[model samples]
Target: MDASTFFILVLIGSAAACLLGSLTGLGGGAVLTPLLVLVLGVDLRYAIGASLIAVIATSSGATATFAREGFTNIRVGVVLEVATVAGALLGAYIAGLVDKSTIAIVFSIALFWSAWATLRGAPPVVPTGESDALATRLRLASSHPTHGGSQPYGVVRVPSGLALMFGAGVLSALAGIGSGVIKVLAMDRVMRLPFKVSTTTSNFMIGVTAAASVGVYLHRGQIEPRICAPVVLGGLVGSMVGARLLPRLRTRWLRVIFAIVVIGAGVEMCRKAIVGGF
Candidate 1:
């Protein structure tokens, strides 16, 4: 397509991603990546680079609201950032030596894995939950304001959570995705944090986690200025609006539909990978 049309697409797409991120705490990665490559005819490598930049922009835009409203736990985010970012750097470095198709195939599998995990519908809440000694000592857990009474949640397997975060970072950097899906899964399942806390905390850490990848993408000349400028600007604005509208739209149906979208996108990506479209 023409330059103007491509720029317009990036703006609109990024705005949508911001909305998704604001509403469900994810955006620009799963949805935008394929669209850029398939519809816009951009190279997958370039699409991934730009999408990773968009993830950083999206998270940076949302961090303030999440923190101000007490939705994000800063200490936990900071602690996890160390592992994730380090992993991202290593993944980015490794990817440079690998074929883009290989990276694409791996990315697609990761997406499917995340979608299936999310589809399990957040397993039953733990009863009489207990935290491991490390979780208790670090105070890495807290209670959130639920519909009825504010219920408390605890985290366990602190070391496991960090290990997963490291793995998530590697995947994200390799794929130019936000890696929030894996991050949340680690905290919610292994760490045993509540859904809200795990999601918000994952959101809190994404920007920091992406920094390592962002630098690598830039240095590798994968990011196009024409794409990044409009997408970033538009995403920043869209995320602000999404954050404001999220509370009002918190309904069961909305969440269910969102999950379906994730699953569909995830499966499509996996199909492409298997077919050697990577």
Candidate 2:
């Protein structure tokens, strides 16, 4: 395809992917990576590099909106970022050693797990009016604006959450995605934060995680400016729009969209892996 046609397709694809990504906290990389490799016939490593750019852009575009609306937990995001960043560096280092098909398989598995976790649905959490001592000491407890007014929430299982974040970062580097699904699982399921708070916080954290891995990709000569530029531009636009739509969406709808998008991408990756794309 010609340069202009490739750019247009990438722009459209990244925009759609980021729209759902910003809403579900998956980040655009999950979908965009597969689209680039499978549909656009880009090399896997190059797709990963471009996807990282999109993930960073999506985070930057959506995070400010979420923070302004009081959905993001900055305290939580900052704390977990330490582990994620560390893991991202390690994962990026390992990515150079692994073959492309292996990366594809691992990426698909992670996506399926993310889909199952969100689709299974968790019970509604009612605030117990008590906060964990560790969380309280760390000032992790916070509130978000709800239809009824401000609703307060508490944090729990800090150690477990941090461990999961580290894993999330590693997978993110391997998959060339933001690892937002695992981040959301850590905060929403393990940390016991509200769903919206978890998603927004995941958005805030993924950008930093992606940035860490991006350096490794850069040194390896995987990042193509031509591919990354349009993808980032489109992702920024889509993420901003998705961020605006999140406040009005119900939790159930978000979960449904998250599961659907993740599963579709996972299936596509699996197909490419079986076909030996590398």
TM-score to native of every candidate shown: 0.87, 0.90
Model 2, range 13-32, lDDT digits (tens) per residue?
A: 99988988776655688778
Worst 10 residues of 2 by lDDT: 121-130
lDDT over C-alpha atoms for residue 49 of model 1: 83
Q: What TM-score does candidate 1 reach?
A: 0.87
Q: Where does the lowest 10-residue lDDT sum fall in candidate 1?
A: 119-128
Residue 179 alpha-carbon offset, candidate 1, angstroms: 1.7
- Model 2 vs. true fold: TM: 0.90
Off by over 4 Å in 2: 121-123, 248-264
Q: Write the per-residue lDDT of candidate 1 for residues 229-275, one digit (tens) a residue.
A: 87788778777777678777854555467667766666666677668
